[model samples]
Target: MSERKMCKFYNLNVPDRRSGSGDGGALNHTGNEDDDRNEDEGIQPYVPPHEHKLEYSYWMWFSQRPPTRDLSTTTTGYGQALRMVGRMGSVEQWWGLYSHLSRPDELPPLSNLHLFKLGIKPMWEDPANVNGGKWVVRLRKSQTGRAWEELCMAMLGEQFMVGPELCGIVLSVRFQEDHLAVWHRTATDLAAAARVRDAMKRILQLPSTVNLEYKVHKDCLRATNRHEEEMNHRS
Candidate 1:
């Protein structure tokens, strides 16, 4: 399966379609010559599927922990470390960007990939997310790839039924275990949050033993700082 994906999409370094560019042209990773192509050029090696516009535009972001530092230390600095890799306005754009990313298991430890609604930064303290919270579940490395894929699909498909409350989702790659999380606009909205929670459970199909946890953004702010201080003291 992995081998086949390489043949179909661009590699990790490939950039997404530049916003407002003409012809929706993207970088062509495939070696096909121009003569065989139609006037429309949007980085697809094969016969591209019909375009489908998404309800909301999304941004693809990536961050890797440097050897000397840990990201858990501060909310403010965490945003500084993130790099916006792509923007997706349509389903085709999503795949065009996602296909190039390293698989969850293949990612280096301490790396993260984030897909969030456009204009809403992934950080918990962002105005769009400051009052919101996140739903997180740890999974085995083996389960990370598929689960992450399905989660993103559900988000893009609007299956959560939570109506613009969701801010973004993340895949955290670590040494021993991986985690998946989805952030929302308001933790206080119990009915909406509950729907988001139920939708996550159904989509991930997590086993009974697995725990799904929710953390409020404001609460996370103080706790995260305290935890960072403790770790610093220990070091």
Candidate 2:
């Protein structure tokens, strides 16, 4: 099936009416009287049938409504991560979460935010991400707004790093600058990683003056200093 058809297969919106009027003609005197009688009898007006149903397969777009059940929200970071992971599968639901979330540049400095698939944790310890790495794009403080937004859109829209190899993406905002990373499921697959990085560069359309880097999760965790020197030395 075509991409548009695939998207529509998952989207359940009511088809629009072709003709303006129904089978019945304009109201006559007799019909007016019947309508008045119906109103007097407390008969309700007609409501069109809802085309969509609430199911696991469908997700809502950019909704502010929190999960109704208590189980989805817990004290642990892992629990919150789990909640996020569970909601990432359906396109509709992913859109809903996207709508409700704060845009990357709007987050406070020194804040770390992660968006990943339901089963995948943003951290390295998760099975899906254990041997994985991330391509980091460090944006100047001024470019945070546009860069972060484009990166988030590219990640969530599946415009980059196609297939199951993509785990998630993360953004870290700091006083000096902001950092964006696309996390993948395997670090050993250099070809796949290169593809992801190239896709990212194309999407962002960065200038030749700007530089981007990719690092393994293990190396990042072991780094004592958060600087270009440490990163270069590790590479």
Candidate 3:
């Protein structure tokens, strides 16, 4: 779907009503063309069909590197290219948007898709993520589509039992192997990180041959800057 069309389906200014009940109170909702028209006509949002609320709200983002630019998690003005495309508070809402964006493999190389908590920017420096770390797995192009979908479901369902320690998921598209990382809120919480890792393995049904790595966000930021400095010196 076109970016403009997709934005029409999400209410960016949803009311804040998050509740422990995981229902009713939430600052999230998905809209459609009908709802857009209704808003313009001073009518209520188009109520979804059999809408069941999720425990937490989320935002989906899309970003891509310029052909000659190297985009990293630490890159400045990263938000310029990172677009918040959809927000979801219910299962049907997620399915509505997912149906339009079939798979990441279909996206161009250097592109990345992020599904993060409602208020969290999909960036390492975002306060919720600065001290966090991510568990990353590289899979062949053929393996990413299914894995990415399942990972999305698992996170939305809170299957890890890590609580809010689990922040979001990032799917980085590349030419051959694709990298998918699950971000957690605390890097020092080894127990939480371990649970995230174990849960990811079970959810993705990863094979023993698969290598999963963990990198603290701060470490990644430092490494990225160092690498860029080296590249500059070389040139």
Candidate 4:
């Protein structure tokens, strides 16, 4: 069965739209007031006893590339090393988690923040993602935080109209450039893919000058594997 059909059959819940909400856009390493405020803005995170439930539960995963590791071997260990930051089923819970976490700018190089639906792991080999691909937007270092925040808000708000086709989103932190990618269920569905791409561009307020690309999971895996092979040969 197609991924979309399967999702509908199971009645998987994505994020719900927040009515009449404006996007307010995250880090800190110090103990000073400025650092404290910057990290969480003094908003204490609270979990409700039994109210304000979200449409779906989500998991947040964090990973940082290991130093001196070969790219091919990286996936295995990297996947293993991913730490589950938290799981939330409500807006309060998400806010609590988001408030305490380090901002994307404060993250170390090669770090990544992944927010995927509760049951799906953020990996190319995962069943939900194996048949999928990502719509990636390259951004300058200065632009990463706002774009990430906007994208996250949009996802949690269910602003993207493609039903079931949307899987998750990722923000990758790099040395010189950062990337934000939207994962979807099928690479072969050009129409759905186009809609998703357009939604992302519109929701994220991406300018025409920004660089965006759609890459199938298989092709992405191939490219990484090829790079790993080259690195191994050089060693």
Candidate 5:
């Protein structure tokens, strides 16, 4: 069936009345024609026919490394490259977008996928995220796609029990190592942050031997700016 028709059918099967900023709010909904389709799932023949509802809607954003004259310039322009790929308030909507899009493994090196609550931008500059920080877990390239999928599912299902402090989740694909991080709204709320960290560890099934780092958004922004300055000086 055509994607549009399939969505209509799914929506008809399960009507939803719960409203949130993401469900009724303005969104960018832009996307590319190419889709990634079950590449990581060994070519599944069937996709479930039921619709699922999430607590809140989310927006998907994508970014890729930018081209530069110098091969070693490393000017990814991640912020500038980021663009809204789509928005999903319901299970059918999410599946429609995710099923067709390229997986993290299929994306180009240095690409990123950000899924943030609707009405909130994925950037640290967003008002909801400015004072926040992210709990990060670095993973080998081979481990990223499945880990990312599980993380997204967990967040959407509200499995973390992290409360309203949960902002979003990001998957950064790099040449050396990929990363999966969950953003929360406060850096100083150690108690809340600890709860979030523990929930994250449990949901992701990380071992006690693994270490996760939480970086404040302000610190990340500062480091980014400093790197830009150094690159400009060398240029």
Candidate 6:
């Protein structure tokens, strides 16, 4: 089946609602001070501070303005901050950001654009992604635009992998090559990860000669260091 059709099938299988209604409003009973205290002592429910409407505005503002060099002053925080701002946790805002942003080839080498959910850092060290990994597809420098566009469309269109386990996608541009990756929260979830990778391969229509690799975040960190060492040796 086609990638789009497969996604639709999975969506249909997802349960529409919870099976049981146990303690449905237990956390929202304002009068129960003890319950509230207990809940607070435990884990607080996730509430996104930024509004989706504001995120859309920010995305448009950033896209229309030319890229700035002085990130320290121009952007209050690092690259991740921009990603967090754009990831407003709403489908509408996410689509808006993707539609307005430039593709990978339009950006300079070593530049990256991460689209992760709000409150989740793109890095592996983040609590949400500590045990995760990414399925990577490296493209020749000439195919950067093709690979980038295909992966971005698959991700934002929710065609790559569309479950809660789907963390995000990343595009990394290097001097000689570019990479498109789908980040997942669990590296051990082979079935889910395989589905994601298959979706990517199909959408990108990768050449049979190209070999895609799935790397755990821990492994990637090590591989990065090794590559740096090799580059230094060549120099």
TM-score of each: 0.77, 0.57, 0.77, 0.73, 0.72, 0.56
Q: What is the C-alpha lDDT of each candidate?
A: 0.73, 0.53, 0.75, 0.68, 0.68, 0.53
Per-residue C-alpha lDDT of model 6 across residues 1-235, encoded as one tens digit per residue: 2222211212221111123422111122234434433333222122234523322111110111124433322222332233222222344444544554565566655556565544455666667676888888888878877777676556655676446677767777767888777888888888888888788778889777778788898676565556656655777
Stretches off by above 4 angstroms in model 2 are 1-86, 222-235
Lowest lDDT sum, 10 consecutive residues, model 4, at 21-30
1-235: candidate 1 lDDT, tens digit per residue:
2332422333444332333434342243334423322232223322234678788877766777666656646665686666555566678877877766668877777888888887787887789999999999999898998999999999999989876888999999889999999999989999888888889999999777778999999898888788788877989
User: Candidate 4: misplaced stretches above 4 Å?
Assistant: 1-50, 69-74, 225-235
Instruction: Specify the poorest-scoring 10-residue window by lDDT in model 5.
Output: 37-46
Instruction: List model 4 lDDT by residue over 8-70, tens digit each.
Output: 211222121122322211121123523333343222223356646656566676766656665
In model 5, state the lDDT of residue 33: 23
Residue ranges of candidate 6 with Cα displaced over 4 Å: 1-85, 88-95, 221-235
Model 5 C-alpha lDDT per residue in residues 1-235, reported as the tens digit of each score: 2333322322222222122221321122222223221111111112234546567877777765544523222324554555555566667667666776666776666667788887677777788899999999999888888889889888888887876889999998888899899999999999878988898888878899999998999887787777777878988
Model 4 clashes, total count: 0
Highest lDDT scorer: 3
Residue 163, model 1: Cα distance from true site in angstroms:
1.4
Q: What does candidate 3 score in Cα RMSD to the true structure?
A: 7.1
